[model samples]
Target: MVQQTDLAIAPRTAMGRAVKHLRQQGIIPANIYGHGQPSVAVQVDALAFDRLRRAKNTRNFLTLRMPDGPNQTALVRHVQSDAISGQTLHIDFFRVDLQERLAVKIPLKVTGESYAVKNLDGVLLHLLDALEVECKAEEMVEYIDVDISSLNEMDDIIHAKDIKLPANYTLATDPEEPVIKVSPPRAAALPEEEVQVAAPEAGTPEQTPIAGE
Candidate 1:
């Protein structure tokens, strides 16, 4: 079984504009609800949640330790951030059941060098960065490793059906969708040459006979 990361949070009483004060104090306001229960308001240390997000992200299940209740397994459902600074403002966690299956998009992790990219200088394009998969909470994964070493030509592609999944997990995305591909290297643009036009030779005005002639 994959080890789950632990996140500790405290029950929150602040609501409305008062929640802004929590953020100023390095506390992020959050809500936790799932399994058909009313959402509970909570708060977590900004620094701690940041570390946890960096380590486990939203794909893996988190062991949530609540102040007034039992620890629960949850998945990060939504994260609201400061548009400019990218600071985390709030979060939403959904409680999960270990024995039940759930669908989530697991990030794709590329591994190994592709012969097309290494030898032919082909560009590698990731058509899908994540895979929609269904699995139990205990079987949730942080990311799926994709091997690109099999790409031997510029047009070579990898499809959803080509990737192997964990024993309990199944792909929810279409099997024929292209996951990754190698494209021919882009051609460099040629520098434009400066063209100088010779000044028009000094010319004398042509004289015409008077119109009444």
Candidate 2:
């Protein structure tokens, strides 16, 4: 089932340089638009937006509550931020139709330790950190877990096709792409031996070359 978060916002009356004061007062400028809809300028409370962003994936459904109009469903499309502080300066909310499928990137999370790594001293290599999938906004997930416990030997690989997805969700990434692999442990480096310089033979050690003899 799709989850929805309701956020209250007000239509933006300020524009251009005049909007700087809104940010100073903890309001984040934003825009909302989608198919068959006119772009609507809006503003959301900075602190409230921060909390919501931290708690949900960008693919999640958001219901924008407007002061004087009907609420709209949206998905975060882009965020503009301060280069120095990384603070959000503006955001673009793409209105979404819940009934339509959308392509989204879900983060990959590794679960379960590999027996080969623990018992055989094999090294684990993570090749992919995320995967793209197509699903309705309500069916989108924050992350997909990939289990590594089945890797039993060095050179064993887990490909994108091996992943399992929720019903109604289809993978968008190439099926042959490797998501994880195990490799044999690296060889240890050998220590260098010290070189010994032999002294001159004892018999003629005192014989110095006679200059102009």
Q: Which has the greatest TM-score?
A: 1
Alpha-carbon local distance difference test for all models: 0.88, 0.88
Off by over 4 Å in 2: 56-59, 185-213
Can you give the lDDT of residue 115 in candidate 1? 93
Off by over 4 Å in 1: 56-58, 188-213
For every candidate, C-alpha RMSD to the true structure in Å: 4.9, 4.3
For model 2, give the 10-residue run with minimal summed lDDT: 184-193
lDDT by residue (1-213, candidate 2, tens digit) is 446788888999999998899999999999998887899999999999988878864456789999889989998899999999988999999988878898888888899999989999888899999999999877777789899988998889999999888899899999999999998876522356789998888787677789999
lDDT of 1: 0.88
